[model samples]
Target: MRLAALLLCLALPVAAQSAAAPDDMARRAAAQLQQAAAGLERAGSARDRVAALTRTIRAYEAGLAAMREGLRRASARERTIRESFEVERLRLEQLIGALQSMHSSPEALLLLHPSGALGTARSGMVLSDVTPALHAEVEELRARLEELATLRALQDGAAQTLEEALRGVQEARTRLSQAISDRTELPRRVTEDPAQMRRLIESADTLEGFATSLASLPADPAAPDLPDFAAAKGDLELPVRGTVRRGFREPDAAGIRRPGLLVETAPGAVVTTPWPATIRYLGPLLDYGNVMILEPSGGYLLVFAGLDQVYGRAGDVLPAGSPIGLMPGADRAPAIPAAATEPGGQAPDETLYLELREGDAPVDPRQWFRLDED
Candidate 1:
């Protein structure tokens, strides 16, 4: 009887050791499961959440296997230990089921598991001391999730604002392009003949008379530099660089005979004056597609026409050699022999005609330009 009691004592310790191994494994699995749940909640990106969930599944599998192995080796008197393990297994099964449900419905998971859905365990009591640590981890994760959600909202709002601004800029550019197209067509409607354009010089004479009258009549003591005709006559320089194509002549049946020196220039070239002058006129004129008339100090009227673009405006004071406009078109008129054509070859089909005037008449522009001598 004593021998049987001794053998029983030895068997009891062996059974206890076997039970302890499974219990330790179960505790470790529970701790890992809790840690993984917290990690999923705290994860800032999708990849991080997936990794945490995977780790939790591995731990749960290991613990389950250890518990089964312990039960197989346990004795009859230690059946209570086996029964306790069975209860734990059932609890784990329920947890895994809840996780599966959450995985199927992310929105529902977010609502039910604000702490975050787990891969193996969804809802279960861990060891007593472990509960506090698990709660702290969950709270930290909740805070991080809230921050991520707020950032996403702000980014969406910013993208929408930028899209609206880009749309406005596109609309404005379309309107500007349309306006330019309209302005380009203006010259086609105004003048048909060069002779009529020469007749228009009468209007310029009328304007000069008006200017002279105003100069004589004005005198507020504060009014600046009243027009000095003599000073004006000597100070201004020629407006462009080119040879005269037509010289001033008496009016004939064909047209008011050329009343100014028509300067010929290359197409698409920049037009400018050799001296500063105030812009007197800027727009379409008879026989001139686009025109700019500048009145320099000496009653010198500098005229430029046949332009594709105008960079200045009426009343602007332009510096010497400043760009006024680009010449129009690319095709150059074929040069016909002087004897084979009209005296100056002044025809509508010709590509050149930029006239200049001084006071009421035109002068030989060739005499004023020093650069042409070279």
Candidate 2:
């Protein structure tokens, strides 16, 4: 009787093993599911999705392994219990039969086992009593499931927001590139004709003055200051339409006999003041067919020559872009022959000469005017 009681005590653990595996498996599955859901929520882009999915799958696979191991251990223990209780086990046999019947039916497995059959002396210590550890693990798993579900929902919403932001950035970049292309091409198309080129030059000169004035003004006091010339230097547009017939030279040939700067433009083309300036001279000079000298508000002198007509007289405060003259006859050295000359000899071509002087010395106009990339 003593040996039988000892054997029955050992068999009790084996009988309990059946419930252990499934509980462990459920716990592991729950933990993995939670981890996967958290990863998904933090994902930001396509790459993020891949990373989250990889981690999630790994967790699930680990849980699956734990579950399989638990199930295997439980099955082995159940077999042992059945074999041990084979003889003089009428009561145990009936319990095993009931257990086996319940196992066979899916619905029965879901229900808790009855307490009295487990052989516990305390009515409180019943088959229905789950181990505290198992109960805690189950609760942990349930919490994780809820967290994962919430995380997954958040991840989905974030992914959509990221996709929309990416699309908007791409569209804006495309439009900006197109605008730059159009601005670059405009100079090329209009420069072919001398008359059109002159107009473009006048516009460019006026814009350069406006940009310079803006640059002279102090930057917004509240905004951070950028490096000098960062906002102002390149902001100015090209000041002439015709190709740079002659660039800034060390011993400037286009300068007055003294030394200054000069740019040859098409004759008869309107010469607009770059800045608000007063006309100082407007008449013929030694080599300049028609000369006009301006004293600009910014303490600079601008001299224009080779004009077919003059619109502003001396003492006139000319605004920027104000038409000053028409291009000269063809006999004059043509600044833009292709643009100024007609098919027949009906009209004469003209050229423009520019000189920028600071006090008495000449500076490089190229530094101020925007040059076409050749």
Candidate 3:
């Protein structure tokens, strides 16, 4: 019921915009112009951010459903191909043995040494019989070899996919330590009092107002503030391996927009920082659940929200790929039907929201890092 209700609340758009539809990437390109605006602007409201996060989760759940089915089909195909290869190999061996047998026979030896014109004529008759059978064997062997080659390729592809899935899981686990270590860290720049923030939020009408207020507050002096975070832009990587369900500044169904990338991942996936930064704020922020904002560089913030649980607090300095939290339902995903499917109709079960900021200005995250293999 939780899953169903959530899906109904946030209808996912198509995974990849079609040729007929407005190019999603084109919109992304246009959105980049937001950064080019005269000065820094504020982000959207909590409700708007939450709504986008909801849609991201719905899309992810759908992808997870499709991925599970694909893995099943791939596993079955792997078995079938392995079995077929064995069968064909035996047939090929038998064909080779038959040819070898014929080569050593009296009939074949006679062709090697014909007696005269009459003997040559007799040898010709034997050769004619042997040639047809040998040709048939060779043709069959050629076909079997071709089939084996195709099957081998399929097996290699399947192995790669399986390896990718395993790697994603392992990477998530590896980040567990960083998350645990930072759990006790204090808040930076923002007040630890939720009541105070709530009071401030009620008075503030816009996200910009709230963020500005948060910034005006005293910051933790010990939080590692990198002077040269600009150098780490292209070198950064994702916290988890997943598909880009949404790009930075992509508008939602209601036209409410945020500057962030939504990664559709599997349940129980790990979440980490793309680069080293101090945790500015780590707690629930109205609609954005379990938010963790990292300041990788001076004036450049990386925001990740919608986590099941967060392991760090404000003021802690984290390394790149530091494990911070995990998504829900790792044992198994909730039975939520995917709202939108991929090109091959696969859906995933989890969502992670990522956004970048240059001071107060929002920027396109697509320019930041390359994605891992699906």
Cα lDDT listed for each candidate: 0.41, 0.42, 0.54
Query: Which residue pairs clash in candidate 1?
Result: 232-297, 232-298, 233-298
Q: Which ranking of candidates, highest TM-score first?
A: 3, 1, 2
Per-prediction TM-score: 0.32, 0.31, 0.51
lDDT (10s digit) by residue, model 2, range 209-238: 422332233322332222332233334333
Best by TM-score: 3
Tens digits of per-residue lDDT for model 1, 1-374: 22223223222221122224433443453454345344434432444332233333233223323332322222221344445435545443444454354357654333343455562134332223334543443354354345334433433333333233223222322322333333321111111134533445444444334233222322223322324433434343444333455555645467766544555543333355555666655666545677666555544565566665565455455545555554553234222212212323332222234444656555544454542420
Runs with alpha carbons beyond 4 Å of true place in candidate 1: 1-241, 250-256, 331-367, 371-374
Q: lDDT of candidate 1 vs native?
A: 0.41
Model 3 over residues 53-126: C-alpha lDDT tens digits?
Answer: 22233233333334444434433444444565565554445556656665667764545533677777765675
Please state every model's RMSD to the true fold in angstroms: 34.8, 29.4, 18.1
- Rank by lDDT, descending? 3, 2, 1
User: Which regions in candidate 3 have their CA more than 4 angstroms from the true location?
Assistant: 1-195, 200-213, 216-218, 221-223, 252-256, 333-347, 372-374
